[model samples]
Target chain A: MREVFQQSLRDVQDRLVLIAELVEQAITEATTAFGSSDVGIAEKVIDRVEEIEILAAELDQLTIDILARQQPVASDLRLMVGALRMSASLERMADLAQHIAQLARYRYPESAIPAGLTKTFARMGALDVEMARKIVDLLRTQDPRLIAEVRDLDDDLDELHAKVFEKVLSDNLAETPANVVDSTLASRYHERFGDHAVGIARQIQYFISGSLD
Target chain B: MREVFQQSLRDVQDRLVLIAELVEQAITEATTAFGSSDVGIAEKVIDRVEEIEILAAELDQLTIDILARQQPVASDLRLMVGALRMSASLERMADLAQHIAQLARYRYPESAIPAGLTKTFARMGALDVEMARKIVDLLRTQDPRLIAEVRDLDDDLDELHAKVFEKVLSDNLAETPANVVDSTLASRYHERFGDHAVGIARQIQYFISGSLD
Candidate 1:
């Protein structure tokens, strides 16, 4: 019985990694759509969000099933709870990625980001994709170093987002109000991507350190 | 043991209600600060968010404990999971309220909603408060009608948010860039409050109906 229970738990973990991979794909493609203003890629990213949501629901049901079957205590309990929390954060990250794709699609034939800041957004997108990929490994390995790297990358994303905000608010004064709004919203979407990743890391920290703070 | 497990579950529900009340107060105080441009009220709302966070964590820990000890299945399991999801949504709702308060603080001596759209924001605030109150009732009764009411309120918030966005984009063209940014961000914050509430209601609906969608 114990072996069977552990097997189910292993299944849950593998499914979680799968969800993270799907989220990474969403982020990469969404940002690709955003940077290039490619409606085709954006549509593909948007379609992928449904798959992420479906997987999230499936993982959720599996976690509940394992908890009922094992009635795990202490560390095992924490792992299950953490899985539920991380699933939520990953789901939100995918939704944010979809938001980025929608912005690209919304302004099709015209990039949501101005040309002057395109390079900045491109940098942000790369950092975001890297963050998503690292999180997949973090889930599989539970490495503290990976969490630290994600945090550092998040700080960089914040800095870049602020730069985008400053440029759009003042330096890009000649831009249309609609375009400015798009830039602001898109930058926010990217910033939230990092924020949700950091949130998932915190949940992992809670699992390891048992600190609620 | 069964009675004890049921008691713990009830405690979880009661604590969830308390968090909802705190969120309600935060939204009211935050909007009051926005409307009056009163930094004092805004600061109070910001401080209250910590209490909300603490309560949210407590609810999470308690839910995990109950699940581990009880191994609740079927409807009981759904109820516990729903509480977890609702607690998260409430915490986020409080954070959104804090964001509104921060905007008010950032633009000290100047109303965050702007004079032209003050009435629109004022209406949003009223609807937000009402929604929070309705959620409390919904949790207590699990009434489907209350869920419908919450959805209706969210629609109202979306409509008001759109008006604010339209006004800032065109009619309020003479406003300073910073003011326009603040208005856009604040309205988005309020809209998110409704979004989160609607999300919680959906979880409740799922709990009642066992529907994944």
Candidate 2:
């Protein structure tokens, strides 16, 4: 029974990695959809939303099962808890991707983003993808130092976001109301994407450091 | 040894409640400062920032110790994890109070919030305080239902904040540039506080359900 439960734990970890991969793919697809204005790609990303949710539910059930069946202790307990947290973070990341897709859909027909603002949004998306990739690596290695590095990287994303805001408010004073609001909300979506990415890093940190903060 | 570990876990839970109490007090002081334009009370909250930080650090250490020594499993493991998350949420709540205090200090003497916006800000603070209180109760009792209710309550806050923005953009057009900017930022801060409060609930939900959705 113990051997079987241990094998199941390993399987759940594999599922977690797969979920993380799917989440990263969704991020890439959604961002690509927005940057390239491909509604078709965006739709594909949105369709994966249910799959991500289902996998996340399964991950949760797996953790509960491991806890009840094997009563994991020491490193095994940490791994199960870590897997659960990583699953949650990945799910949130996927949701953010879906949100971006919806935003892309909203901007279909006519791209409302100003050139300066679009560059900022693009940078934001790149940072998000970068963050997500780093988090997955950290999970794979359980490297505490890598988890620590994420905050500084998040600072860069934040700085870029602030610069984007300044440029939008200053350079687009005379733009249409619709254009201004769309750009502002788009910037907000990008910022939130950064936030969710940071959240993933924090979850990884909790797994290693045993505290979220 | 098992009994000692169990007692330590209980101690950690007790400390979490204490931290929540401090957070509640800080929010009350900060909100009162905002509502009354009391610079003195705001100054006091700023001074208490370190206290919140220290309490958070102490709680973190306690959580790590429990995890390390007790090596808890099942429900016991969840309790420790919950304690860690609750501390994090409380720390952030205290920081939000400090942020509000800073805002109050910036707009000192001449209260920038116009009389018309008073009701909106007041309502925002009220909801925040209520949510903070609810989280504390949930932590105290290990109640599961409040976890879901926090999300529902947060929706009301979001609606209230939107109404605030609509009111400002529509009715406060004649206001001075400084006041307009300040009010906008103030409203944003309030909205963010609501977001953080909802976050505490999310942590509680994970504690109750052992899942993050």
Candidate 3:
């Protein structure tokens, strides 16, 4: 029975890693689509949202089933709770990626980055993609060091988020209201993607350290 | 043992209601501060965020304890899962409310509603506060009927969200980029608050009906 429970725990971990990989793929494609104005790639990311949601739902069911069958306690139970949260965060990361892709699709012929803010947006997108990659690694390996790495990445993302606002509010941009709205929303979506990444990292940290700090 | 589990379940329900009530107050005060540029009230809402978060964490620990102690299955198990999710939604609702209040505080003495969209923002704020109130009621009563009510309110809120974007993009507003940024973010925050409210309603629906639809 103990071995069986361990297998179920491994199953939970594998599923989380799978979902995180999908999230990484979604964000990578999403950033690429947003930066290059590639509508086709954006459509691909949009179409995968439902797939990620279904996978997340399945993962939740599996965790519930494990709790019912295995009744894991102590560290094992913490793993179950963390699995549920990590799945939710991973799913949210996918949704944010979809939102980013939709922005690119909305401005198919035109760029969503607005004038004078393209480089800033490019850096922001890169940061989000890197964060997603680190999340995938963190989930697979459960390395405590990656927790701080993800948090530091979020700090950088936050700074870029503030920079996006600063640039938009500055007089030198000469952007239209539409550009301002899109840039604001897009920057927010990117920043939120990083936040969700940090959320996942925190969950992993809690599961490993038995503390939420 | 069964009776003890029942009491624990009741405890879970009561805590959820308590957190929901706090969320309702947060959104109510937040929208009021947002509308009136009342920084004092906004600060009140901001200060309570940690309170809500702490309550949520305590609820999570209690649910985990229940799961470990009683090993509830089927409907009871669903309740535990739903409680975790509802707690998350309610906490997110509070965070969104804080964001709205921060906007008000940041633009103190200067309304964040921009020039032409004041009425629209007022309506949006009202919808959010109404949804928060309904969430508190739904958590307390577990009435499936409130689920539909919450969904409909979100629809109204979403329409207002779209209208805000429309007005922002229109030429007649003659607003600064800062105004555009604030309106976009404020509208998004309000919309997300409604989304979290809908999320809690859905969790209730699932607990009652055993279907996620």
Candidate 4:
């Protein structure tokens, strides 16, 4: 029975890694689409949202089945709980990616990044993609070091998020209200993407260290 | 064993209702602070964030304890899963309220609601509070009717969300970039609050009906 439970856990971990890989792809394409205003790439990201959702639902079902059949406890039980949460965070990361892609799609002819703020947004996007990659690595390898790495990347993303607002509010930007609205939402989406990455990382930390902190 | 499990489930239900009540108060005060620029009320809302967080953490622990001890299955197991999800949504609702209140406090002497947006934000705030109240009622009574009601309120909130963007984008508003940013974020926060409420309602629906849809 213990060995069977371990196998179920391995299955859960494998699914989580697969979902993180998809999230990485989604954000990578999303950033590219947003940076260059590529509608075709944006559509591709949007198309995968349902796929991620379905996979997450399946994962939830699998975890619940494990709980029912194996009735895991202690660390094993925590692993199941962590799986459910990590799946939710990864699914949210996918949605944020889709939101970023939609921003690009909406402003097809016009760039989503306003003048003077393009470079800031590009850095933020790169940080998000990097964090997504680290998440995939952390899930695959369970490397505790990658957890802090993801959090440090989030700190940088937060700074860029603040910079976006600062530049937008400054009189020098000369952007339209539509530009302000789009930039605000877009910056927020990118920041939230980073946050969900941090959340997944923290969950992994909890699973490893056996502490909720 | 059955009776003890039922008691544990009731305890979980009661804690969820308690958290939901706190969330209702948080949004109510937050909206008031936002509309009137009451720093004191905003501060009150902000201070309650940790309280809600602690309560949610306690509830999660209790549910896990129940799961480990009782080993519930079938509908009982679904209820446990639903409880975890509902706790998360409720905690998120409280955070959104704190964010709204922070917006009010940030602008302090200046109102968070811009000149022409006062009425629209008021309506949105009222809808959010109403939805929060309905969530409490639904959790307490387990009446499926309240689920549909909460969803209908979300639809209205969604339209107002779009209208805020429409007015912000229109030439007639003539607002500052700061105003556009705050209003955009405020509207998004309100819309997300409603979305969380709908999420809780659906989880309850899933618990009662045995379907995830």
Candidate 5:
């Protein structure tokens, strides 16, 4: 019975990494779709969110079951609880990716962003993709240094996000309010995606170090 | 020992309601600050977010303790897990409110939104306040009608959010791009707050009925 519980716990951990991989794919494709104005790719990312959602829910149930049956204590309980939080954060990160894809889909045939800001949005999207992939690597490797690196990466995203505002508000911008709205929201989505990655990093840090900060 | 565990569970539930109340207050003040250009109120809301954060963290620790020590199962375990999710949703909602307040602060003295669209944004802010209040009432009452009502309220926010886009994109709009950016992002913040409230309502419903829908 103890072995069965341990196997289930390991299974949950494995599934979490798989969810992280799927999230990485979704954000990468979603951002790629953003740059290329590929409705097909964007649609694929949107479709993939359903799979992420399913995995998130199943992982949630697995965590709940382990908590109830194993009645884990101390570090084990903390790991289970942290797993629950991490699952929700990853699911939300996927939702943010979906939001990005939906923007690409909404402005199909035309790029979601104006001509001047495509490079900016693409940069933001690339950083988010890197951040997403790093989350997977962090989970697999459990490296502490990566947490600070992810934090620094999010700071970079914040800078890029501010620069986006700078570009949109610059005198040369001739885009419609509609374009401004789409680009700003999409930029916010990417920035938030970085924040969620950082959040997962903190959760892993806590899971290992038993510290919140 | 079981009785002691039940008491701790109840305490956690009580604290959860307290955190919800703080979230409601922040959104209320933050939106008020948004319209009035009241930097003081906005700053207060921003500072109060720290309190909400602390409460959320404490509540989380309490839930972990109950789960680890009590080994709660069935409905008790479900309630605790739901509480954890609700705490996160509420904290993010508070962060949204802070973002709203930060916008107000960022654009101090002058209104963040254009004069023409102020009414539309004010309406959206008012709806979010109502939705936040309704979340507390729903938790207290567990009335399914409240859920439908909250859903309807979110629909109302969505409409207002659309109208914000309409006003921004309308001809004869003379606001600076900076003003447009602030208004759009603030409007998005209020819209997301409603979504989080609805999420908590669904969590409550699930806690009661044990159904996802």
Candidate 6:
């Protein structure tokens, strides 16, 4: 019975890493779709999000089952709880990625994005990819430092977001109104995606340090 | 020692409700400020968010103490976990209210809301209030039905959000570019605020049913 519970635990951990990988792919595709105005890629990300949701629900059931049947104690309980928290964060990250894709598809027909705007978005995407990688690393290694690094990366995302805002407001007043709205919304979603990533990092920190800070 | 732990639990529960009330006030102020373009009310919400943060951290510590000292078993453990989860959702709700206020202040210098937008915003605000009330009632009563009611209210918020999206996208295209951007961001923030409220409702549901729908 102990072995069976341990196997389920191992399965949950493996599925978590898989979800992280899928999130990374979804975000990358969504960012590329935004940068290139590729509706097809954006549509793919939107379609794949259902798989993320299914994985999340299944993982939730697994955690609840482990808690109820195995009756995890002490550190084991913490790990199971952390897994549950991580799943919610991961699911939200997937949703944010799908949101970005929806916005990208919404704007694909209207205008050519300024090169500078594309560059800013590219920087944001890089930060997102870095954050996702660190989350996976934290899961694999259980390293606490990477969680702090994730918070630092979020600071970089905020700087990029501020730049996007200033550049759009200063330089794009004469552009067609739809173009401005689309670009601004895109930037805001990217910033929010970083925030959610940082949230996941915080959950990892709580798991490692047993502290919410 | 048991009595001490019970007292601490009650303290934490009281603080949670207080935070919820303040957050409700913040959302109310945010909605009114947005409709009236009242920067003062917006700033008030932003200022009070710090208090919510402090309460959130305090609640976190209290929960940890309850778990470590009381060593709650069975449904008691569930109650402790539920309080921690509830604090997290409420903290985020408070943060969202602050963000709405920030958006209001951000667009204050040139208040150029289009016609009919305020009514839609007002309706969103009503839905937000309803959602918050249902969540508070659930927390206070521990009644399972209120959780479902909260979910039902979230559906109404979703409908309002879709209507706002269509109205803003189709009607605001010919406005001055800055006005269009500001209004778009404002509407997006309001829509997201509704989503966060739904999140709170879901958390309440989890507390009652030990599952999320």
The TM-score leader among the candidates is 4
- Highest lDDT among the candidates is held by which one? 4
- Give candidate 1's error at residue A120 in angstroms: 2.4
Worst 10 residues of 5 chain B by lDDT: B136-145
Which residues of candidate 5, in runs, are more than 4 Å off?
A: none
lDDT (CA) per prediction: 0.86, 0.72, 0.91, 0.93, 0.89, 0.76
lDDT of 5 by residue, A1-213 (tens): 678777987898899899999999999999998889899999999998999999999999989999888898888888888889899989999999999999889888877798899788888988898888889888888998888888988999999999888889887878878788888999899998998899899999987788869
Residues B176-207 of candidate 6 have per-residue lDDT tens digits of: 55566666776676666666666666766765
RMSD of each: 1.8, 5.0, 1.0, 0.8, 1.4, 3.7
lDDT per residue for candidate 3 within B156-181, as digits (tens), equals 99999999999999999989998999
Of 4 and 5, the candidate ranking higher by DockQ:
4
Between which residue pairs do clashes occur in model 4?
none
Q: Lowest summed lDDT over 10 consecutive residues: which window, candidate 4 chain A?
A: A204-213
Each model's TM-score for chain A is 0.95, 0.85, 0.97, 0.98, 0.96, 0.90
lDDT of model 1 at position B154: 96
RMSD, candidate 1, Å: 1.8
Judge candidate 5 against the unseen true structure and give its global Cα lDDT, from 0 to 1: 0.89
- Docking quality band of candidate 2, CAPRI definitions: incorrect
After superposition, the stretches of candidate 2 with alpha carbons farther than 4 Å from their true spots are A1-12, A33-47, A64-80, A102-115, A141-153, A175-213, B1-9, B30-54, B67-74, B95-118, B141-152, B168-213
Classified by CAPRI criteria, candidate 5 counts as: high
Task: Find the number of clashing residue pairs for candidate 4.
Answer: 0
* Residues A34-96 of candidate 3: C-alpha lDDT, one tens digit per residue: 889999999999999899999999999999998988888878887888889989988999999
lDDT of 1 at A37: 91
Error of 1 at A145 (Å): 0.9
On DockQ, the candidate that comes out on top is: 4
How far residue A182's Cα lies from its native spot in candidate 2, in Å, is 5.3
The digit string of per-residue lDDT tens for model 4 on A1-213 reads: 999998998899999999999999999999999999999999999999899999999999999999998898888888898899999999999999999999999989899888888888889999999999999999999899999899999999999999998999999998999889989999999999999999999998988887756
